[model samples]
Structures are given as C-alpha cells and as structure tokens.
Target: MAKPFKNLRDKMSPQAQNASEEKAKKMLSEMPLQELRKARQLSQKNIAEVLSTEQANISRLEQRTDMYISTLRSYIEAMGGQLDIIARFPDGEVHISQFKEIESLQNSKSAQSSG
Candidate 1:
C-alpha cells in the first residue's frame, strides 16, 4: 500500500521552519493581476467603470505582460488595493514610495514658503 502523506514540518529545524513560513507568506501575498482581480470577485466591467474605460480595455490590460505604473496603480486602486514597488538586494528589501518625487516637490515648496 502507498504511504500516507506525512507532516514533516514538525521534524524541520528552526531555520527551515522560518524559511518555510516566509515562502508561504510570499506565495499568499503575490499573484498575477488577473488572478488578484478575480479573487476579489470583481468583474472586468466593474473595473472598467472605476477606470472610466471599456470592458474590452480592461480585458486587454489583464492579458498584457507589461504596463505603465500609472495604469497598474489605477487598476489596483479600482480593485480596492494599493500597489507598492519593492527593491530587493542582497542585504535587504526596500519599499519604494510611489509619490516620492511629488512629495519631494511639496517638501521643497514648504521649505521655500517657510524661509
């Protein structure tokens, strides 16, 4: 008879356990944009209305492998979620601000006005 599936997590080392947990978290958090939209139970027509576009446009957008950040941001916001850009290096990961340039301009204006 075939052996039944075994839960090997109990026998894993602490480091292995941590690594597994991290992998699980990453898998749960990330997926294709179309999958994310469908998982939210949103229709293409619904997203099109939010973006003031046609359903066909939304459909085409989902099929695309590349798109502008603004387009992605708008689509994500339509699905009631925020998009974050991350930079990963050997040392660590950095969450890049979406509006850094705009924020910097505002900060500069504030400093100028205060001066």
Candidate 2:
C-alpha cells in the first residue's frame, strides 16, 4: 500500500530532481535559530553549557525577534559557525566588516591589558 520514497524520487525527471534539490538547499539555507540548532543536533542545554549560561536563557534568546549582533555572533560561534553581515543590492552584495573590525580591536586590547 505504501511506496518507497527512493523509488518515487528515482522516477522524477532530471530537471525536476535538480529543481527539488535547489529548493531543498534554499530551505536549508534559511531557517530560524531554533531550527538551525536542532539541525546541528544540539540542545539548549548544550548551547547553554558552551555559552556559560543557563538553558532558560538560551530558550529566551532563541525566541527573541530582536537581539544584539554580538549576542547572535556568540551564539553562532558556540555552534561552531561564524556569522557574516551582508547587504544585498540590485547589482551585488557587500559584506559589512565593521563588526569584525570591532571584535579584532577588542581582542587586541584585551590581550594587551592582560600582558
């Protein structure tokens, strides 16, 4: 009564398969923080431990519609990923490096102060 998914997929034309794959890639590229965490096989407790925070805080952060870029960057870094700010235009896209420069400056200052 049930058909195998592989068999169904195999029956599709090459164009349809390519389209389906592209759609899947697009969907994967755009997901909420919660979905991304789950896709990475990480739990709130795991992220909390990495961030030296509580699980409840991680939950609240994921639900927030607005958060600081630094907070978002730290969260992504805890998940073994980097965040980039990109501005898209009609002609092209630009990577905003101001945030990265600020981070570099802070790191250098901290290193100097510690030494």
Candidate 3:
C-alpha cells in the first residue's frame, strides 16, 4: 500500500505558484555536488569513467571534507568544468593562481632536469 504524491503547486494561486517555482529554481541552482551532478544529467558511473576510478571512489570524493587541489581539479575537469579558486576580503575578491603555480613548478623542474 502506497500513498499517491500530490501536486502541491496545483493547490496554490497563480502568483503563489510562480513564486514557489522561482524559489525552487534558485534552490536547485545551489545544490550540493551529488545534486549538481544529477542536474547535469550525469551519474557517478559517468564521472568515475572519466576519472578512471570506481563509482565508490566518486561517492567517497563527494563526501570528503577536504581534498587536494589537484584531485579536485581532476574531478571537475572530468565533468567538463574548469576549477577556479577565489579569495574574498572586505575590500573585494581576487582569483588565486597557486593552482597554476603547481603546473609551472612541475614544468620548470622537468625543463631543468632535461637540460
């Protein structure tokens, strides 16, 4: 025995329904990692395939409290996204470039070793 789901919007006035719809849209836009992936029409399997990892690892990655920038960048890039780091202060915000520095450092080290 299961109860049927009702359309709550149907009971609302037109204006109220419109407002509710807008709120719902905003909330969806601010969803967490798992919801964002689903909203993008992707599954953990899809992400795992792109990252060359197992589905369980993707789930664990999403649940992690903190992760390395390189690891996060790999996950985001696999999802067709570019990761950006920003710093915000009372004055304003600034885009951090340390992530790029990691690449530059590696490149310089390799060049030195090769030369």
Candidate 4:
C-alpha cells in the first residue's frame, strides 16, 4: 500500500503559489553552498573528494556570494539535485510548464563543460 502523490497545481491557491515561487527565487538567489551541502548531509571534504580537488576549494565555493547559473547547475548536480530559474510576468502569472523546462536547462548546463 502506498499513498499517491497529490496534484500540486490543483492544490495551490494562486496567491499561495505566487508567494511560494517568489520566496523560492529569492532564496535561491541568496543561498550559500555551505547551507545546501549541509542540508544534503554532505560536507565540503566530501564534495572536494568527489571533484578530485582539495577541501579548500570546496570552502571557497561555499563562501562564494555570486552565483553563476552554470556553476550552480553543476554543483547542484554533483549533490544529486538541480537548479532552476523562472520568470513572473507583468501580471504576476507564471507558467507552470516553465518549472519543468528550467530543470532540463539545469541538467544540460551541468553536462556541458565548455559553456
């Protein structure tokens, strides 16, 4: 026996969805790598080890304040996650499909090395 997933689109009120999406975007913009890594139960040393780099390199990445979207994508991928970007229109209406597309972009960016 298992519970089926709920339809998030049907469940979310327009106001709630707007606020939640805005919050997500703001958080992503300000998020530090250290917090994300810790939340994933990973350490800088662990990531450095995987990347074949020194632990100090991980420390610098964690302290980085500016996020290059491409870099963020790769880092997130290494943690078994992905980054996304979305836009809100003049009426504050966001397309639901954009979420999925953004995820694909993240995957592609991570896979690319010369971008």
The lDDT, on a scale of 0 to 1, for candidate 3 is 0.85
Q: What is the C-alpha lDDT of each candidate?
A: 0.86, 0.97, 0.85, 0.74
**Residue-by-residue lDDT tens digits, candidate 3, 4-103:** 4356657779999889889988998676677778878899999999988899999998888798998888787888988889999999999999888996
- lDDT: which candidate is best? 2
Cand. 3 TM to true fold = 0.68
Candidate 4: stretches off by over 4 Å: 1-31, 93-115
- Summarize candidate 2's per-residue lDDT along 26-50 as a digit string, tens digits: 9999999999999999999999999
User: lDDT tens digits, residues 1-115, model 4?
Assistant: 6544346645889998889889988887675678878878998778877777888977887788786665666677778885666668887865456656766786788789656
State TM-scores per candidate: 0.64, 0.88, 0.68, 0.50
Off by over 4 Å in 3: 1-26, 104-115
Best by TM-score: 2
Q: Kindly list the per-residue Cα lDDT of model 1 for residues 34-106, writing each as its tens digit.
A: 8888889999999999999999999999999999876887899899987778899999999988565655677
Whichever of 2 and 3 has more TM-score, that candidate is 2
State in Å the error of residue 90, model 2.
1.2
